[model samples]
Target: MRSFFMPFAIYVLGLAVFAQGTSEFMLSGLVPDVADDLHISIPAAGWLTSAYAVGMVLGAPLVAMLSIRWPRRRALLIFLLTFLLAHVLGAMTSSFEVLLGTRIVAALANAGFLAVGLAAASAMVGSQAKGRATSVLLSGVTLACIAGVPLGAVLSEFWGWRSAFWAVAIVSVPAVIAILCAVPASAVDPNAPTARHELRALRTPRLAVTLLLGALVNGATFCTFTYLAPLVTDVAALSTNWVPVALALFGIGSFVGVTIGGRFADTKPLQLLTIGAIALLGGWLLFALTAANPITALALVFVQGTLSFAVGSTLIAQALYAATDAPTLAGGFATAAFNVGAAVGPVLGGIAIDAGLGYRSPLLVSAALVALALVSYSVARNAAHRSNHSRGRSPESF
Candidate 1:
C-alpha cells in the first residue's frame, strides 16, 4: 500500500485494455473491407463484433472461476498475453473463418483481463479509495469509446482494415510491459477462491438482482449510444468531425462521474442512484427533443453517457455487498452484464430504427427502461430496509 505506483496500476491496466477494446470495436468501420475481402455482405462482417461480445459473456465467469485460485498479477499477465496473441492471429489470418476464430479467442482473453483487472484494482486500494480506484480502472473503458475506437477508425481509414489489428498488437506490447512493471506483486489476494465458492456466490437473490440490473441498465444506455453517430449526422445535421468531440465530452463526463458516483455509492447508494436515475431520464428527454440541434443535442448525449456509465460502479458495489461469500464470482458476472448489454443494445436499436420510427426511438426505449429500473430498485430497497428493521439491524449491515 505504501507503494505510490500501486494504485496507479489501475491506469496501466486501463491502457492495455484500451488496446484490446480497440481491437474489438475497430471492426465496425471495417465492415466494408471485410465484406469485400471475404466475399460476404456488410451485415455478415458485423458478426466479428458479435462473436467477440458473445465470447466475452460466455468466457467471463468461466475464466473468472478458473483463474480465481491463481495469483491476480500472474493471471492478469497471462490474460494480456493471450489478448496480444489474438491480435497477432487476426493480423496474420486471411480467411474469414480464421478471423472469427481469432476474434473469439481474443474475446476470451479480454474477459479474463477485465474481470481480474477490476478486482486487482479493488484489492490494491483501501475501502476509502475504492471510488477513485474504480474510476481509474473504468477510465480505460471511457477512453475506448473516446480515443481507442476512434484511433482504430483512423487506422482503417488510412491503412487497410487488417493493419488496424497490427497497430493494436504493437500498442498492446508496451501496455503489457507497463502493467507488468507498475503492478505491485504483493497487491494480490493469495486465496482467490475455488470453483465451488464462485458457484455458491451466484445463488444470492441480491447478487442476481444487481447483475440483471447491470445488464438491463447497460443495454438501455448502449441501445441509444450504439446509434449516436447516426443521430448526430442525420438529426443533429453535423458532419463526422464533431462526433469525436461529442464522444470525448461524454467520456470525460463518465470519468468524472465515476469518482463522484463511487464516493456517493460508498455513503449513499440508494439516494445517489435515485438522483442519477432521475437525471438519466432527463438527459434522454433532452436528447430526444433537441436531437436536431447540434450543440444542445451533443450536450444531452454527453449527459447520457456520463451518468449512465457511472451507474456501473454503484451496481458493482451493490453486487459485492450481496455476495459477501464470493466476491470474485460476483465481480466477473457483473462484468459479463456489461458485455451482454454490448451485444443486445445495438441489435435492438437497429430494429427500432429500421421500423421507420427513426433514430430517436432508442432514446425513448432507454428512458423507459431506466424508469422501470428506478421503480424496481425502489421496491427492492424498501424490502431490504424492512427486512433489516425486523432483524434489528441496519440496511448497511451486510
Candidate 2:
C-alpha cells in the first residue's frame, strides 16, 4: 500500500474541491453585491444559489453516468478546466441571467469534479483506507469554510463580487496545474458497467434507503443552518461581528469532527452514525432552548457543526459499501441526495418562519428531520440484517 505522504494525487483533488467549494459558498456572502450590481431584487439574487444547488442535484449522477467509461484522472482534469472557464465567464458577465447560467455550468463542473475525485481517491489506497481517503478529499469543503469562503467574502466586500469570481478562476489555475502533474493517466475500464447497471444499483432497496438516510441527515442540518444568520441576529442577539465569529466556530468544529470521524469510518461507521445523529439531535434541542443566551447559543453552534460533519463521512462510506457494484455512480447519487435535502430544507424552514414560528423554529424542524433519519437508518439496518441471516451470512453494519 502507498504511504500517506505519497497521496499527492489526493491533495490535488482536495485543491479542486476547495476551488469549487469557494465558488459555491462565496455566493452567499456576495448576494447583496450581486443584487445591487445587477439591479435585481434580493430574492432574485438568492435564486443564484438555488440554481447552483439544482445544477449539483442534476449534474452529479448525470456526469458520473456520462463519464463512467472515462479515465478517472482525465475526467477530473476536464471538470477542473470547465470549472475554471465557467468562473471566468461568470466574472465577465454583466447580465443577471448570464450570471445565473454561468453558476449552473460551474456547478455542473463542480459536481463532476467531486464525483470523479471520490472514485480516484478510493482507487489510490487499499480498501481499508478508503474511508480515510474520503475524509481527506472532503476536508476541502470544511477547509474552504474556514478560509476560502471568508477570503471570498472579504474580496467581495472590498473590491466586488466579480472580483471574487475572478479569484476563483485564478485559484483554479494552480489546481488544474497540480492535477496535471500529480494525477497519472490511468487506463479507462473498458468493461465498466453500463448506464443501465448504474441505474439498477439505484433501484436496490438497501441502496435506496441509504440514499434517503443521507438526504434526511443533510436536510436536518440545513433546516436550521440555512437561516443561521437571521437566527443569530434576531434570536441570539449578537452583533454583526459575532456572526462571523460564530461561523468560524462552526467551521472549526466541522474540521475537528471530520478528522475524528475519519479515524473510525472504516471500523465503526454504524456506531459513529448513530452517535453523531444523537449528538446532533441533542445539539439542536439545546440550541433552540438556549438561543436567548448568546454564549450558549454560540457553543451549541459549534457542537451542531461537529455532529453534522461527523456522520457525513461515515454515511458516504456506508453508501459506497451499499453500492459496491457502482461506487462512482453511488457517490454521485449521494451528492444529489444531499443537495436535494439542502434545497428542500431551506424552503421548509422558510415556510415555518413565514408562518411566524420565529427563527428558532427552524431548530425544531431540524430536530424532527433528525428523528426521521434515525428511524430510516434503523429500518434499513434491520432489513439488511434479516436478509443476511436468511442467507446464512453475517449481517453488515448500517
Candidate 3:
C-alpha cells in the first residue's frame, strides 16, 4: 500500500514545490528590471526579496496553526490558489509598493505549501523513506535554481520582468491541476494533536537543538552564497559574465548533494551530518584562501555548494524524528528557521564587508558558523545518548 501510493504522492507534491520555488527564486533575476520599471533604486528593489523572506518566517507557524486540522489536500489547494493569485497581482501591478505587497502574500502562501507538502510527503512513506521523500520534494528548489532562475532572467532580459511573473502564474496553473487530480483527498486523523499541542512539542531539548543546528547550517551556506557574485567579480577577478555560470555550477552541485544526502539520511543521519561538517570546514577554508584565483574559486565554489546542501535532508529528518509527537508544527518551525537564517545571513555578511573585511571574509564567516553547528550537534547527540542509556536503551531506538 505504501509503495503504490507513495511515488505518486511525492511526485505531485514535488511539482507543487517546484512551482512555489520558481516563484520564490525568479525574483532574484528580475530585481534590476523591476527597479528600473518601478523607479526605485536596486537596494530598494532588494527589499522585495527581504519581504518574502520575512513573510516565510512569520507565515509558516501562522498558517500551520490555522490549517493544522484541515485536510492536507484542501489546505494545499488553498495555499496554491493564493500563490497563483498573488503572482497575478504581482504581474499586473504598476506600483513598487503593490509589487512588494504581492510578494509578501506570495511568500506566505509558499511557506504554507512547503510545510504542508513536506509533512504529507513524509507521511506517505515509512520512517526509512522519509529522507528520500523530502529530498524529492526539495529537488524542486534545486532544479529551480539551476534552470528556472536562468530562464526567468533571460525572459526578463528580452521582454520585461513582469513577463517572468506571468510565466510563473501560467506554469502554476498546471501544477494546481496536478495536485487536484493526482493527490488523494484523505481524511484527517481523529486523534491528531491540536496546533497548541504541536507547539508544545517543540519544547523537547533535542528538537530545539536540532532546529537551531538547522538554522545555523543555512546561515553558513547563505552567508557566502548571498555574496557570491561580488566575490567572483571583485576578488576572483573574473568577468561579470561568469557569475551566471558560477550560479549554475553551484546549482548542479546542490542537486547532486541533495540526492546523495537523501539516500543515507534515514539510517545514518548522524554520520551524514558529521561528513557534511567536515566537508564544510575543508571546502570553505579552501574557498576563502583561493578566491583570488578564478580556477580555484570556481572549483571550490562547486565543492562548497555540495557540502552546504549535504545535510538538508538529514536535518529535516532529524527535526521530524525529534518531534514525532507533533510533526506538522515541527515541519513548519523548521521551514521558518531556514528562512530566518536566510534573511539574517546576508545582513551579517554585509556587516563584515562594511567592517573592512574583503569579499572573501564571508566564506570565513560561513566556515565558523558551520563549525559551531557541528559543536552544537555533538552536544545534542551526546545528551540524547545519555538519556537513552539512563532508560537502558540505545540511542538508535529513536
Local distance difference test values of all predictions, in order: 0.77, 0.84, 0.84
lDDT of 1 by residue, 101-192 (tens): 99998898888888787777776775544545556666677777677777877877888787888888888898888877888775435565
Tens digit of per-residue lDDT, candidate 2, span 1-398: 43545288888888778888788888889999999999999999998998999999999999988888888878988888999998898899889998999899899989988888887787777577667777887788888888999999989889999999999999889988888888888886678777788778767887788778778878877887788888888998888878888888888887887777777887788778878888888888888888989989888888888888778777776777777778779889988888888888888899999999999999989988888988888887888899888888877544
**Ten-residue stretch with the least lDDT total in model 2:** 1-10
What pairs collide in candidate 2? none
- What stretches of model 2 exceed 4 Å from their correct place? 1-6
Off by over 4 Å in 3: 1-6
**Better by TM-score, candidate 2 or 1:** 2
* Candidate 2 to truth, TM: 0.96
Once fitted onto the true fold, the runs of candidate 1 whose alpha carbons sit more than 4 angstroms away are: 1-6, 186-192, 396-398
Q: What is the lDDT of residue 254 in candidate 2?
A: 79
**Candidate 1: clashing pairs of residues:** none
